[model samples]
Target chain A: MTWLRLALANLRAAPLTSLVNAALLALGTASIVLLLLIGEQFSSTLARDARSIDLVVGAKGSPVQLVLSSVYHADVPTGNIVKADADRWAADPRVAHAVPLSLGDSYRGFRIVGTTTDYPALYAAQLASGRFWEAPMEAVAGAAAAREAGLVQDRRFAGAHGLVDGGHEHAGQPYRIVGVLQPTGTVLDRLILTSLDSVWNLHGEHESAHDNHEHDHDQNPEDEHDHGEAHEHDHADAHDDARENTSMLIRYASPLAATTLPRQINTESQLQAAAPAFEVTRLLNLVGLGLDGLRAFAGVLILTAGFSVFAALYGALKARRYDLAMLRCLGATRTELLWSLLLEGLMLAALGAVLGLALGHGTMELIGRWLAASRGVSATGWVWLPTESWLLLGLLVIGVLAAALPAWQAYRADVARTLAG
Target chain B: MTVLQIDNLGFSYGQRTVLRLDTLTLNEGDTCAVIGPSGCGKTTLLHLIAGLLQPAQGSVAVCGQRLDALDASARDRFRGHHLGIVFQRLHLLPALDVLENLLLAQRLARVSPDAKDARRLLDALGVGEFARARPAQLSQGQAQRVAIARALVHRPALLLADEPTSSLDDDNAERAIDLLQDQARAVGAALLVVTHDRRIRGWLAREVQLEPPA
Candidate 1:
């Protein structure tokens, strides 16, 4: 039998001690591996979703909320900005491209975002089939939204008035699906796109319906018909300043805009400008506090595991003293015995590392599925970080270090004295 | 040929002398017993001969190579190549089965394992059926036989047994002595048995007596 085989047999001799050592190491590794996976996936997905959009300009509110609502479409928009004001900023020399988004409607819990074609260009989203919307009532469905809502080209579906389900449905003003977008692995995958006029027309009808109810309280029902007609004309003649869009996604034309644009918009105008990069960093720092605690917890577990392995090996060494002597009598050199003990420690460590990585990835995949369902953000376990290789190397080093003392004792063991005793 | 020789061997623990011996020699295939009382250092003498201890003063040779002339590692190598030892307790590794214990001896001796030879040794020792049984699972007599098989598996030139039959009844002790001597003769190895049990003296042709120094 090989020395490694002997080491394995030795480990098997005390199943409980070996198992406890391996388990402690596995728990420590799993914690760190889980954190590494989730942290990397979270930040990368956040960064990918927020790419290209330098600043989000919207109604005055929390900068983080604005970024969340406008960039990720994961939350409700703070409020709306006047269409004319957003258009004026879109024309600014500092702005490379500005895509206006009008929110506040949904078809089956998937938001119906009324935006220009430049919005698709923002994500570089391409059509999977069919064509883009050419009219106010024509709509395009994102890949996830299309598959989830069973939307196809030429299918007609009326959007609800609110971003959630059970809102008042615009049954009379149904939209025709003109296209479906390919998956961009971004927030766009969860949205239905339409022209801005579709939102205006839909809400205009609701306002007129409210006006008709007021007429029923005072004037005759015949006046409601004429009043609705008048409201339509007023909507048609209304100045652009009176109309509003929810938020404007702005890209900087030059690096100088990064220094001046947000400050200029926040101070000179009635809009809030949130830089995605800055808000994301602040957001990460806040989450990082909790992550730091977990990291420290994992660190303690790993050190304790190292200690446990050492104790197990050292304890076993005491019991196996006579065995060592017998091996010496059988002509095993001190170095051979030493390496065998080290091999035992390394074997336990390798087992822990493999189990830990498998557990980490499995848990992350489950979490990713839940997040994809609850929030619109996509997080996946399929990604591997480079640092994990270092983690494996570090675990092996811990194995060798944990075995160092016991191996030294085995190396220096006095065979004859031990045998005589 | 002189398979074992010793001259003026002496060992001490600190200032206290543990053992002292005059000249002794055993030729190839010779059988002898070193009989003594408790604390007479018969076990220590066996250890010194096996290269497990460096004597304070002595010239010990096996196959005409002086042990003290070689480095520690070289001595270990020489012992592995030339000597086999059976202790009083028959220290078979509890982890390995009877067969694997013999295989372990060959491996530790840096020789390519000969499973056929190991099996044949076990069979000759009459513990062939217990080849796959763990040391813990075997009876004391069976374990002793397995230990004997392990010692002679590599066919060493010198065989050392310290108190090999001290724990057995007379009949078993005689059988154990007969097995050891017969195996030693088969392998052409000189056998040295150390024990405080004077009963073993009758089984060997030559006898040496050890006494605590005055």
Candidate 2:
């Protein structure tokens, strides 16, 4: 404690140099922590939303974009797959459940998804207020969409002609909100859910198209089109179906489905099937490299801060060498002089670490709030990683190493010659 | 009472012998001045007695304890408890106040720090009010007095001052020598002053002269 006072006095003597070193260290630490926070939140959210679904069959295009669009609702859809084709998968012995999504319109930056009651069941999205829609043009608002857009029962709003906001509004055919979903903490929280007929009608398609979607979506026991070929079922009707271009979601019934299903659909059919897990992994691998680059850049900044501390102490020692010599004469051991320098370096690092951690978390929180407001995703929080703790320890080690040369110099200084001058 | 003694003392800087004192002694409470030329090794002889430098061929025994037989650390401990040295330059720590400067010496010597003794010595030197002021805040004379107070803080048996009056004018120089002798006598310590200034020669009854080394 006695030595600490002396070290603090020395630090206080040169305030500007100490502050600059600390600020640089804080900047480096903040960057490292922020990077980890972003990486963890991003990968976890993707993994969380893609857990149950196995394959997404869509129009032939980018597989990653298919998963990103259908599974995560972050990109443009790969067009549409036939609703009957989705039903054929749903009826397949190997398939557990198939959910179809019709995308291409949004309200205030939130996507309005036209899906079945199974969509709400998939995400466990219970209605927080009012009932789930049963009729065309009646919509259930997602928690985030409701809260952000101030959506309420009886409120009518036109959806623009894109997955995201601001393409062109279908102002004449506005849909009324009947329900608001409880916060499910998934991508479902950011969508407005309705029946597929509402979507076709809103786009001003033929009225019979809405009746066709509603008709073909259920069990058509007495159908005139499929009386002879009962086994081929929805597949023959879906070939001429206009909804063939729309994207469809598929869930695997067994592990065998993963190996056989997507490959068969991609190779043998006009549509493509992309696994969410596989595509999300590939997507993150590409993004991780960029994040790693950013983290490495932050590491370099911390290294430079270490060098600055070393230079500051070495330079200051030239002037204070006499003080050390005098302390020796006053009966202070050489080791005490050395420790003073080491302790000073440690003090600077401690200040920087504390300040850096605060800055790092504070910066993350600011970005998180912005993301929630702008992107409708909460990606920042007070999450501590073991690596961050290790990073702090590494910083302290750097501080000690930075002080070694200066402290050793102080220890080995020629006291007789120093005082003689 | 204990006294300072040196026999066949010799100290060298590389090939050149800087100090060689065949015989030197000071009894208890005695006041003496060592007068010498610039290259006569007066300071070197003082360092030999203080156990700061090793003599190549002689024994330095202070109060019957052979300093030459002690190892570096032992010699340092022996010097700390038995000898007080005041350097030519006032090498007070700029970081500490005047009182802390004196207290630090006692602390480093591994002796119980007595604030009362330190304050009393500072009071005797007329720098009592500057006890809390840093060396940077003090004038040359005040810092010099503080340095003297630091040396006498532990009240060692032998007090050594190496050209302590060299930077002072005649009036201040005489006053400084008087103050050093007065404090040494009060503490029952033998005072030995090494100086190039001949003015202080008249103040001391006993004087030892060191001729320039060959």
Candidate 3:
């Protein structure tokens, strides 16, 4: 109790210095917390997307990119496989279902994925308002896409030419928004989805009919009337054939078959297979390297904070010599004097740690909101209290040890000379 | 019987021998004034007697206990229980108020200082009104009074003051000397005041002069 009183007195003596030390410690703690939060959120998003698809088959690009385009709805497919090759895998008895994807054009920055209705069911996506697209040129927007583009059900918008910028004319074939998906807390929340036939017809129409000399091989001279009728139908459908797709998303029933099917398709067919889980895991490993570096930087910062604590306490000891001498003269034992100084440092560390925890949690909340608003992904704000508590305990122990050096010096001081001088 | 006995006591820092006293003794209730020129080791002798430093050669016995035979920690405990010390510069803790400073002495001796004892001590010293004032706020004379109160608070067997009158004028010095001696007597403790100043010699029952070290 006596030592506690002395410790409190010493802290009250130097309020500003104590506050500065606490602030430095808090800064280091906050950095570590921010790094951990970002890493966790990134990994969680990847894991969530991986769970949606058993396998993702796309062009032979980087496996990570394949997963990013197919499962995460980020990036574009390198190339597309023939629909005839996809039909062969779909007919297998071992295959429970196959969902093919065709991708090419985009609306703003969001990719427009042309796939079957099974895509929403595979992702367990729910409609926030209207139903999924059933006809060609009808569109289903992810929550992020709808909210960002200000598109509601039954609203129509012209498709952009390239994936990145500028709209192109399909003449009269504008896409109608038919559905808006509920927020899925995953990358799927930021995509525009439609049917494959819509994209294929648009591109076919964009091809000039003046180059129709090659079409005569598939026509017969005796079917002149039918050929004339077909040519009239092609002109009527010219607006629908203004756009073309470049990629497809394929899902296999079992992971074992999905793994084998992509290789088979690549060997005998013109398609490739990409596994979302493997690619996402690989991406996390790559990201983990950067997170590890950040953690190391935070460790160095904390070490510096410990050193600062040592220097601060050591400097304060010189000014406190007289006070210690007076205590000795007043009947304080050397041990009591040492304990008092140690207790003061411990108190400062404990207070700083508690404040740092609060600060870290608050920062996470702010970042979570910012990421949700700016990046279209919701960051989880679950408190990792156990890890944080352990960190604080370790810091407190280091701080106590740092303080012991000065306390030992005070204990060994020559009481009489200190008082006499 | 003597309360403090010093025989052939010697102390030095590095090659410079500061004190070499052949003999000194103080009986209970006796007040002795140690007088010498500047740098004459009066304070050194007082420190040796207070057990703050060990004599290089010879012995010091306080209340018939051999202080030189004890180790550092034991000597500190013995000092806290049996000795009162008033430093020349007062050395009051600047963080604590005047009353807290006095209470600190009693606390160090493991004796609880009740409000009554603290108020009584303050009233007797004529600094009762400044009990709550920090040491930095007190004037030199007032700080000196607070230091004296702290030294005597534990009712120690021996009281050692190092040049308590050096910083005060004659009038304040006389008042300080009277208060110190009276307080020591009232607490039934022997007083040893080390000073080069000769003006306060009248307050002591005996006078000893330390010669320059040979």
Candidate 4:
């Protein structure tokens, strides 16, 4: 108790030094914690969305963009894959299911993803209310989108022009909301899902709807479904059903299928195949490199903070030599004097660690709110990272190291000489 | 019973011998003063008896315990429990009030401090009203009084005051010496005052003079 009393009194005697050191420690802790939170959240989101998607088959443009658009539901489509080309891949024995998506419209910043029921089935998404879209001009909202729009069953609303909010509203064509999905913590949670037929009808690209329609059944010789659609309103069409789809998301039937399918499709046709696992890994590595550099920068800052704590305590010890001598004269042992300063350092760091954690998590919450509003993805930002304990331990070690030199000086204080004058 | 005993005691900083005493002894309830010329190591002799310095040649026995024979920690504990010290420039802790400074002595000695005793000592020294005042807030005389109270609060058997009157004015110096005598008599402790100041010489019944070594 006496040691504690003297230590606290000593620190109280120099409040400015204490506050400065504590502030430095807090800033160091906050930056490190913030980096960890954002890094973990972003990477895990990438990994989770990439896990089930095996490959994306799309037009011959950027494979990276095709993968990003199909798997993450972000970025513009890399032009359209012909319906026949998409159907040929979909009917392959090596492919488990090839879900088609027609994108390019949005309802309140949430991407209106025109996909078949198999797409929602791939995510195991269950409807929280109403039912999945089964007919043309019907949409089902994911949990996040439903919360944003707050639409009731059978509510009719027109979509916006582009893939985000604030686009000019398409007034003439309107779709009825049929259902809302439960939260899945996947890309599906941010989408307005519907059958691809709704997209074709919305764009007036369906067989009967296209102004100058043409059906080329000879193009898909292997597809049994196309045999009945041989007849064509064979006028020159500006935008036809043949060039309808944005991309096709492919799931392989087995591990063996991945070894040959991507290269086979890319080489044999004008379409490109991008495996989600490969593409997402490449993307994260690029992002991780930047984050690693930031972590290193944060490490340097923390080390500098440790040095700041050291310099402050050492300076205070020098100025308080008279008081330290008095303490020794009051029968405080050298060990007691040493421990008091060491405890001061630890206490400063602990205060900083706690305050910094709050600051970091609070900042993350603000970012989460902004992202949810802008991208419709509800970020789980308040994550207790597994590495948090290690980070805190490192901070404490820095604190101890900072105080050690000052404490040693305290231990060797010349009580007799200091009190002589 | 003798409270302090020294025989052939000496101390030095490196090669220069700072203090050497052939023999010095103080029994219980005795008051004595050591006066000397400047640089004759007046303060060093007081420090030797208080276990703040180990004699280079001989042992200092306080309360019949050989202070030089004990290890560092035990020597500190011995000093805490059995001796009180008052310095010329009073080193009162600025953070603690007058009462807490006195209580700090008892706490360091591993004894539960008696607030009543501390207050009574403060009252005896005429600084009882300022018990809650910090060292910086107190007048010089009042802070000196608190320093004396701090030394006496732990009920030590030996009180070593080094240059206790060096910085005080004539009247305050006389008053401080009188207070020390009264406190030592009341506690039944031996008092040793080391100073080169001549103003305190008339009040001392027994005195020893030290000259620098040739």
Computed on C-alphas against the true complex, the DockQ of each candidate is 0.65, 0.37, 0.51, 0.61
- Sort by TM-score, best first: what order? 1, 4, 2, 3
Residue B179 C-alpha lDDT in model 3: 91
lDDT to native, each model: 0.85, 0.81, 0.76, 0.80
Model 1: CA > 4 A from native: A205-238, A369-379
- Per-residue CA lDDT of candidate 2, range B144-177, in tens? 8888899889888888898988888989999999
True contacts kept of 2: 0.21
List candidate 4 stretches off by more than 4 Å.
A82-97, A107-109, A146-152, A159-172, A183-185, A202-244, A251-271, A373-375, B13-15, B202-205
- Candidate ranking under lDDT, highest first, comes to 1, 2, 4, 3
DockQ of 4: 0.61
After superposing candidate 2, which stretches have Cα over 4 Å from the reference? A51-54, A87-98, A117-126, A171-173, A200-265, A268-270, B1-5, B23-32, B49-51, B61-84, B99-103, B112-121, B152-159, B182-192, B202-207
lDDT tens per residue, model 4, B1-214? 9898888877788999888788888899888999998989887887788777778887789979998888988887778888888887888888788898989989987779889999999998899999888899998888888998998888889888988888888998898899998998888778999999988887866788887755
Pick by lDDT: 1 or 3, better one: 1
**Candidate 1 has what TM-score?**
0.90
Give the Cα-based TM-score of candidate 3 against the true structure: 0.79
Candidate 1 backbone overlaps, count: 0
In order of appearance, the predictions have TM-scores of 0.90, 0.86, 0.79, 0.87
Candidate 1 chain A, poorest ten consecutive residues by summed lDDT: A223-232
What are the C-alpha RMSDs, in order, of all predicted structures?
5.8, 4.5, 7.2, 4.9
The digit string of per-residue lDDT tens for model 2 on A1-421 reads 5578778878886899999999988999999999998999898889878877888888889999999999998899877666555555556777777777788889998888877777778777799999877667789999888988988887899988887667788887788999999987788888898876567666534334445554443343234222112234444554234453257677778889887888878787778889999999999999999999999999999999999999999999988987787666666666777888999999998888889889988888899899888766777657788888999999999888889999999888877767666
